[model samples]
Target: MSDRDPSVSDEEWAAFVEAARKDGVGSGSVPEPRRRGFRRRPVRHEPEGWRTGPAWREMNGRGRARRQVKGVVGITLAAGLLLLALRPDLITDRLPEGFGGPGETAPLAAETARPTAPPSSEVFPDHPTLKEPFKGSPALGWANGAAGIEVPRAKAVGGMSSEEVAHALDSVKRFLVAANLDKATLRGERPTGAIKLLDPLQKDVRAYIHRSLDEPDENNDPLGLFSRFDPAEVRLAGDVVKARGRMTFEAGERSGEVQVHVDYTFVYPLVKTRPGFDEVARTVVRRQMAFALYDPAKIMTTRGLLYVLRMDESAGNSDCARDGDGFLHPQFSEDLINAAPLPGGPEIDPYDRSKDLADLPKACGTVTRT
Candidate 1:
């Protein structure tokens, strides 16, 4: 009456039934099979909220790994910030205008006598391009072209009428524009416009200008009166030249004459003549000159023409050891890398217009700023 295999022994069948009964087989529940060399441990009922199971343990391990990774990243970021705070100058010089670097401010009027802060030690600290030729310079805020050369209100001076004084001031401004801002004159060409404004009777001054342009030397430097550059070596970074200064008039030392004084600083941004170069170097030229305006009625002189009395100039960022080539050779970053120390007097701040030209040393000197 048994459904057991007929080939099975009676004792073996009895033992199998006992094992299956112990495992809960045929008791209206499924049973786990027993392996030959393994014994099953008794199962205990665990609480519902217990998370000691295999899946929960794996998830906890992954969470711990994520927390460790986050800790490492946070430590790295803190260290970098600490380094930056400790050594700000490491990156401050390289930062472009605005992200905590030096910012450009509006230019003060040429007549304003306010004092300016000392310039940075680096002459060319910022990387420059044609679009931002005046980068890292105070001249960035200056007026372009002839706008900076402002004339004071004309008034009677040295027995001259207001109309005559106004005419004299206008003529002086015109001569300045032609000599320094004219594109043709800047390209190492003769400044005919400036020369024609001179009085024909001032033979000595006229001859000096002609000689300087024709045969420039240490003594007869044309840069004393004009701002010229060699086209083969460098070119203007942009069409605009930054200029700032003032003009005034006073009674002359002699009778029937007025002395028109012109004091101006010109900034010229230059780049290499070759293609594919973006580096910029600036030359600062400050000219202080006196011109005599004679009244035609009292003195036998041309009414419109100006008489050059005295001229003094100072140039910054130029090659102190250059030959008499009649052109401004600005010292670029590359040129200063391996160049010998310039033999000159103490460092002079070219941008400081507060100091008189006579106060400047009479020898070649280094500059504090470009």
Candidate 2:
């Protein structure tokens, strides 16, 4: 039902009718459309730079540059490490043979120096043969000829009777004295007459003796003492005697003729002191027999050129008297009858009998004795 006025005049009715007509024509008021919960979605536009295109491409270019730089740095670091790992000798300087540096050049020929003496070659060929089967023992053998002189006595210091041992010690003392006297003569110093008897009358014999004296003390012991030089047995054959003893090498190996711990002894009356002593001395001088296998031809032809100036004459004299320092003074010392080796040196017996020639493999190295 609609609410309306009950009493209406004609004019009032006409006016209301007129107003209704005007409302119908104009639709002055209409119910608002019911509001809905959902809202209109907004339109999306691309960002300013993206609209230009190639946005991803530009980003990738910068990323690629960074990766390339990283790769280059990595490679550079690896190259540096490689250089550090490889230790290269840098000096271009060339030095003479035996110079102590990587730049110093060693003689190619020297690497193969070996025994060349006929006896050494015949006894010890490049390889062993039946003829050279008997390599001398440190105790005894003829390095060059018939086996060396015999001692006739073969008792150990401990094994010998008290009297025999006493005699042996006395002999050693005498040998030392004789050796000292010989060293004096070699140095142009006054030598006891006893020294002349020890002197090698024959050139070859003297050379052999000198070689023994000149042998370097490969052992680094400051005293310059050999590791071993012990004698065991001496077998006499006429004038020649094969004195056998154990000789210990620096390497501590005991092979064919080398001994670990035994002294070799051979004694004879001094030729100068005793008339007709030449026969006894010759018989007893086992150096010939012992060195027979060594090749004399292999000695170094290259002489040291450096002049040893301001050398301590007394110190040098003492060194020669005991251990020969061949490098500094190749010439044998005249003060003592025996020879001395040089400092920073090589073997006194330069002869090469690499194998059978020396009846043993030649030993040499920065840390070894030849």
Candidate 3:
């Protein structure tokens, strides 16, 4: 059985031959089909059979090449698409530095960021300076005064600045001291600044703190931070902050329309000098956390008051370390090994006033900075 149409007549053959002669044999012309080295391979013929013709031979070669070409094109296109899917950054990063500058760039997917706080020296210069917690109204109500008992400062969705968020986190610097040294906070007495940071979520969250401090677990007291003695002997410095770039807060599981998300990492040292001991005990606490709060009235400056709907705790280490130059070095906690959803990272921020980070982790265990 022949695969050719098999019904071709003498008339069709005559027309094909006429067209080939007219278009071929070089009357100063190259047929489109012959451009790619496509030509008929001569074949033995059987009388009156369609398979024994030049036209058939030419048609077979042309069709085979066309199919192979189509397959190659399809395969190449598919491979290119796969590569692109795996690495969209290859295309995105090549865009101009200002590709989406100023108020035009799209925000990142989540607020998953570490803090970018300025160094400790810059934020709070004098250490061990005691501050009394607000004696009356603030711990109870708006204490913000003219702003009224209702703070209307909650920012719009994604409106809080890194500075603002860092400020909120920094506001707790003294709190750490107070919590560790001052009895006021432990008993639920929050300072004016600390009150603001704890706003919207104030009471319940304060209770949470009290409970944590009261926990009887030894591990919970890590190096006596929660159970230690001596407020007069404690001294510390920190550079807590949020990650640079587009840091944004969105509505959390509890409804963002009525709340704002707050997340950051805090890095600081816990320095304590004992009355009888000559050497001071030193430890660094690197705490990373994600929290959501409710303050739709914008009470906490528009982002609403922080009401800690969700929280995560990272590592903190008391291991004393010395730099290459022999100066003591601080670090995030070792608790990450136990259970820190987000592992701790070194402290970093643009506002560092230190001449150098001692080249930092490199500076650790290395020669002291010259």
Local error of candidate 2 at residue 97 (angstroms): 22
Ranking by TM-score: 1, 3, 2
For model 2, what is the C-alpha lDDT against the true structure? 0.20
Q: What local lDDT score does residue 190 receive in model 3, on the 0 to 100 scale?
A: 34
Clashing pairs counted in every model = 0, 55, 28
lDDT of candidate 1 over 111-184, digit per residue (tens): 64424543333222344468987765667767897999998888887888888888889989999999999999
Check candidate 1 and list the clashing pairs. none
lDDT of all the models against the reference? 0.62, 0.20, 0.25
Q: Where in model 2 is the C-alpha error above 4 Å?
A: 1-160, 180-183, 189-370
Question: lDDT rank, highest first?
Answer: 1, 3, 2
lDDT of 2 by residue, 1-370 (tens): 1013224444664464456445553233321111101101111211221111111211322111100000000000000010110112211111112222232233212112223441221110111112322111111222221122123332333222334333433333343233322333323323333223322312322343344344533221111111111011111113222232222111111111111121232321111222332211111111111100001122111111110000001111012222223211111112224422222322221122232312221221010100
Q: What RMSD, rounded to one decimal, does every model reach?
A: 37.6, 49.6, 33.7
Evaluate model 2: give its TM-score: 0.17
Stretch of 10 with least lDDT, candidate 2 = 68-77
Could you estimate the TM-score for every candidate?
0.69, 0.17, 0.29
In model 3, how large is the Cα lDDT of residue 216? 22
lDDT for 297 (candidate 1):
63
